[model samples]
Target: MARVKRNPMRGGNKFKLGVFGANADGCLSITRHPDRWMADWDDVLAAAQMSDRAGLDFFLPLARWKGFGGETNARHISYETFTFAAALSGLTEQIALFATVHTLIVPPVYAAKALVTLDHASHGRAGLNMVCGWNQPEFDMFGLTKPDQVYDQGREWFEILRRTLAGDAAFDFKGEFFDLKGVEGAPGPVQQPHPVTLSAAFSPPGRDFAAGSCDCIFTTFTTYDDAKVTIADFQSRVDKAGRQAGIFAPVHVVCRPTEQEARDYYQDYAVTRTDDAAVDQHMAMKKNMSGSHDPAAYDLYRKRFAGGAGSYPLIGTPEQIAEEMIGLNNLGFGGLAMSFVNPKYELPWFLDRLLPLLEKAGLRI
Candidate 1:
């Protein structure tokens, strides 16, 4: 067993920060701009190394099986997440490496074994972001149907993975979605019990799954006041289950030296050069298949969808962005997962400008 490093996700930073979706072209932005992220291997590796050195907490990759049909055909190419994490494990230290997995597609036993391998490879800096399968087109690519009882299947899938990762004696398990006998794996994860598990949940069943099974839950919000209500509700569920959890939000940021520059850039990429067809396909599918956002967001936030996959917007100067973050922290959000137009080129600037304000505001040390 390798020496286990302290998990940065659970570190003392009052508001944890991470880079999201660098594995996919254009990331969360549905843009056709020439400067859009190409997501080549070299650039991806550079982004991860940059984030690790910048003291960002984690690097979360997207799991996309196919691209949304459009001019750019966003996310058509992506690295398999488990392998991606394993590859990065040896190259970086400090930052957590998270692999996004769809429960229905990847068997629990295989996922468990692979995660332990990642844990060993990373010497304990591995995390899992469990996503109940969404995107019917992606499922169609596998010739599989998205089940109505998806969360139920996810529950059983997690249970099997959990037990297998425990490295206990072999056990038999049967559930509505899966049936397995003599399931067990070797070399448990470096993080005691298991590595940190997260779920991006928005619907009631999804939220319940996160409350019951995850170390943290990711959700989208329209407004702070609305988010407060949702957070309270989710936290209450966690409390009732006699578990502790953190609530996180995802954001797309465009920070600049001046507010005008930030807004201008956001307008340029998200609206002016936005991939209209891509946005249409992405939003229509999301609205129909996933409950990842507020209902109103579908109509009101097309620009936001192009900006960062319908994540909360953080477009402003460092001070303004920091103020919004501080407000989020005050509103009980544990942290944020952020996306940029091109993390390899933009992340350094974001950190150089934002980290000091966050530290000064006591959000980070």
Candidate 2:
């Protein structure tokens, strides 16, 4: 087997773009009003096909064991992550498929097998987004006793995952949470050792783990200053760990033909949620997990609704959004994980208008 050469200019060259898809039930925005709804199976498959044709790099479908927001209708209560990816792999030809795997909730060996299976299904176009389980209710649904146990379990899970995905036929891993003896994955991922691994971590331990293990780190911040500081902190940690930071940023977007149109659409789609109960529930979850009733984050959230910009700030005219994307590219981010307002309508608009601009800007194919 040949060694996989790391792209030294991967982060600085151009923006590798991707889209976030609906996993099980449908693709619904947590913050936005549940106005647009795509059919569970056909619409999602079509969306994947559209993204592939649009020269998108990857499509990430978030996994949730149970609903988080108060709105129970759009919450995914259908197929599992691996299953959804498998179906998408059959439907789409080029774009990579990423499934969200909660490390703390899932056994590492199981997760590894699932990813390997998806890689085989996709024929080398599979990835994993490793998430440290944050939802307390989801843990309870799994019969877990305490939320604090999640971090320790996640550490152990990653240990097993790193070793097992190496495809070593005889690997021994003994940890506090998981113990395996000479286990190896069959039909190892076509992407060398395994598929691409990603994470979204803001805390110190999370950042350290991402720097050491993940192929990309998914992050979100309200302002450019906040984003710069966050990226700098992560890069510092990566440097201290003697590892290269591959890519870092969130995977959401809002692009339009004009800046006013983009802002109007952003506010109309995201900020106009009529279901206050769902928003409150989401806020409560955020508070409990991170103690971040930080008025700043909320203010930023409001700004996103008000056409200002939010955590994943890629709003403006095509040229302006492209410039922001270039800024991210310069900041050692290898990819943009993007999502649209209403994928059925907005995706085609993006492909027709914004993508051409991005290509001219040397950020896309």
Candidate 3:
């Protein structure tokens, strides 16, 4: 309902870059290694600065209500995303600040107001990523139960928030999950008509929700070839729905001087010296929530557990890794979101060394 003229992340760049979940516990690397762990003010602010100076486009955080228990307590103590984004907005420039929220937990009226406030704090640089509640234990902790129809509930939640942000007159809405009475958000978002919104949806209903309600969509693929089919189909679906949205691919990147070096880094950090307890707990929760119908689906998520939580691994020389992302660009991917184990240590190298190569290839500005 809000008028979105041009996507901030896609203003001129064909393939934009964003930092995913770096503000929350290494984005699920599930390790205790100090090098790869994060969730402190200094670490988060530093990474945001690097992304800002390096011309990265956005910083998206995870909304983890609870952690997967292990020696490390994976994702156990995440800083709240909304507050984090609001605070970080004061320290950075250019890069968008994204706060993730669980639709089941955040009341639509309050959630809409919070987003508008953050957009003002960022001077119109705020965005939202919405997720249906998963992790049954996480819900139980909040004295709640997982909804029977998660996507349907989320769809209703999104509609309420959308109208709350865009409506010119006082409005009342009644949906399956929400009911509002003569309420309107005032001093609307700094970004006319509202800040960017994103949804991470894969199934048919989920994809349809994204097509109709979001300015961006976050998703993943098993491989680059698989991406061509998936991205094209999703794009067509969005077009048919009369919405032009960007689908940003999520991936784990291990770029070094050579393929062997990259493999060695991945093996040392994410595999060989992996945090077994955390991985097991994470995998169990994923399996319980996912209900993987086929063996193929199970194997795929199982591998994602071992890797960095379902992100396609881009491991090789810097140039090789850049080229791999370029391939996603070829597949019609609007952009890429990265989850790094040691973003503070590694992201600068990407900006200094790898980004130039990508720019030369015409993937970035």
Candidate 4:
């Protein structure tokens, strides 16, 4: 095996890390397999508190108008992301909160207002994860035809967000998908023109948008080499656009204790292959959606599971995971968006066993 090289810039500082809690139970659904697991607002609050105590830097909860993976009935439907962030802001101090917002489903003006509110509520510790809608079924439910021009839609949405959050009192936006006439956004974000804006785009246009506008890009690549190439590609786009390179953060499925223990946990949650119907539904949805079967995307997802790419890098002792994270820091990743097989159980392990190792590695939290 090739030895992983740690980044010199990191010195003793570990990169930032976060978690995903889109599912009610905070578990990644595998097609048809339905597990009666749902996380309540209390769970989210507790998790945030735990992460803060553990010295993690951020906590992100993705937004979905409808569930994509199997386990169809949307769970934890009451707490909208903005509202939840507001509540969490009062509950914890320090950990940054990133709420996902879908551009296709929300107007930019309204989205900006909500995010700005969060910035105030959280004392300027708010961020956004921008997503262009990919679910056709949800569009139909919203009484709209599926948008054929996704790139245009994304660009319009981002432009509006950027402008509105810039504290413009009377900005005009005229685009193919959206038209605004002298719109003003009040209570601009606390973070200067705006709070942190993040995105997870893999296509050429998506990459261009991130390079141009996003402060951070969420990626999902399986291997260090692949991640390096992708980062370099994104940096090139940013350079061409005359913008500084943004932070790169990737989501990982992590299990701990040891590599063998991590593998066992993955098998327990991800490899059982139950719920064929749910799996079929998810696959069908992917098959019908834009960029669903893109060869490169599929290859990355497969590598994540096959251990060539997707295997969790932070799955051993805290020291081990910290070392792996340090390696990624060397590769220029500013942070990680991580998910565990069972957060209720594993999160405690992370705080108790792993966090100190990160501190020892030089990360302040």
TM-scores for all candidates: the values are 0.98, 0.87, 0.93, 0.84
Off by over 4 Å in 3: 1-7, 32-34, 291-303
Better candidate by lDDT, 1 or 3: 1
**lDDT (0 to 1) per candidate:** 0.90, 0.66, 0.77, 0.64
From the highest lDDT down, the ranking of the candidates is 1, 3, 2, 4
Q: Rank the candidates by TM-score, best first.
A: 1, 3, 2, 4
Error (Å) of candidate 1 at residue 40 is: 0.8
The runs of at least 3 residues in candidate 1 whose Cα sits more than 4 Å from the true structure, single-residue gaps closed, are 1-4
The whole-model C-alpha lDDT of candidate 2 against the native structure comes to: 0.66
Give the C-alpha lDDT of model 4: 0.64
- Residue lDDT tens for model 2, 1-365: 11223211132336777766455433435444454534357767777888877867777776667654555433545457777887887777777788888776777888888888887777778888887857777778888654465556676787787677787577887777667788776766778766777886666677777887777777666566766777788888888878876655554466777789877766766666533455456555665674322346764475342221124657777678777877777666777666554566667767677677777778765
- The TM-score obtained by model 4 is 0.84
Model 1 scores what on Cα lDDT?
0.90
Candidates 3 and 4 compared: the better one by TM-score is: 3
User: In candidate 4, where is summed lDDT lowest over 10 consecutive residues?
Assistant: 1-10
**What lDDT does candidate 4 reach at residue 93?**
71
Off by over 4 Å in 2: 1-13, 24-28, 31-35, 69-78, 146-152, 291-295, 303-310
**Alpha carbon lDDT at 94, candidate 1:** 82
Better of 1 and 4 by lDDT: 1
lDDT of 1 by residue, 218-241 (tens): 889988888999999999889988
Which scores greater on TM-score, model 1 or model 2? Answer: 1
Question: How much does each candidate deviate from the true structure in C-alpha RMSD?
Answer: 1.4, 4.0, 3.2, 6.3
- Per-residue accuracy of model 3 over 1-365 as CA lDDT, tens digit each: 23223435646777888888887786747655557666777988898899988978889898897777777777876888889999988888778889899888888878899898888878778898988747788777778888878888888887788778886888888877777799788778877767888887566666777887788778767766767777777788898999788888678877787799888877777766667788888777776785312225446555455557766788888888888877888778888788888788888877788789888998788
Model 4 lDDT, residue 73, Cα: 41
